[model samples]
Target: MPAPKKPASKKASVRKSTKPQPDQKVLIAKDSLSHSEHFKTFLGWVQDKMNENLIHLQTPQVIESTNRHFMVSGKIEAYDEIWDEWAKFVDN
Candidate 1:
């Protein structure tokens, strides 16, 4: 086996900032709270302001309709043999 390599002794690094970073999200939240309080006072200072508020809410719905067709894609039998003629007559 080959001899193992020795590790480096000295390391280099950049200077760090002494001042703390400002939390913008926290500041924005505080501002929002003050603004909301002012808004509530203007809007009669009641919980029913939610009803007076003209906010649009959205909802999603999905609908699918399928005919009485046999999906014989994953079966062992042939596609034609999967659904009988009698079954087709009953479906109509």
Candidate 2:
């Protein structure tokens, strides 16, 4: 009862994310022959292409997959190229 209590601030600090954007693509398994298989195959193709592309690339690439999902880590452009060349491997 000596000093009056000060009001506590209820505002929480929200920080803007300054993290660099990830350079990879991710896919989740969701359906039939309209199918996740083709998408799975496509990610495999992307992984293969990225490995080939990485032969001269400064950054390394990594591929990870499971029955439920798939992900490839590296430069996003490599994923885009494989997207353009999914039917076959890139000559790299």
Candidate 3:
């Protein structure tokens, strides 16, 4: 048996609309937190937002959505190609 070869390059397929600007969010969070209780509340809010918007590798919903969109264009039929596109979408 032989080892599987890695992909040579990544492709773009589906994209996410929500991408948190870390610096901006942190600034806003800091501004809102004037006390310990407020800071904890703010931290919880941030964590919740991250979980809501961030894609989990083990989940299939996002990948399925991407594949559906890509099919409309008659391009990019594989899930592997969309990882970079998803990351870029989230980064923005």
Best by lDDT: 2
Between the candidate structures 1 and 3, which one is better when assessed by lDDT?
Answer: 3
Predicted structure with the largest TM-score when compared to the true one: 2
Candidate 2 lDDT over residue span 3-84, tens digit each:
9889998998999899976443322212231244656676677777767655534323322233112232245475776566
Per-residue lDDT of model 3, residues 23-46, tens digit only = 987656545443456545544554
TM-score of predicted model 2? 0.29
Instruction: Kindly report which residue pairs in candidate 3 clash with one another.
Output: none
Tens-digit lDDT track of model 1 for 1-92: 99999997887888999999869996666566455645444433232333322121111111121221222122213322323321232212
- How many collisions between residues are there in candidate 3? 0
Instruction: Provide TM-scores for the models.
Output: 0.19, 0.29, 0.27
Q: Which has the higher lDDT value, candidate number 2 or candidate number 3?
A: 2
Q: Report, for all candidates in order, the number of backbone clashes.
A: 0, 1, 0
The 0-to-1 C-alpha lDDT of every candidate, in the order given, reads 0.37, 0.50, 0.48
Where does model 3 exceed 4 Å of error? 1-32, 55-58, 67-92
Supply the global lDDT for candidate 3. 0.48
Instruction: Score residue 40 of candidate 1 by CA lDDT.
Output: 42
Residues forming the 10-long window of minimal summed lDDT in candidate 3: 83-92
Shift of residue 53 alpha carbon in model 1, Å: 39
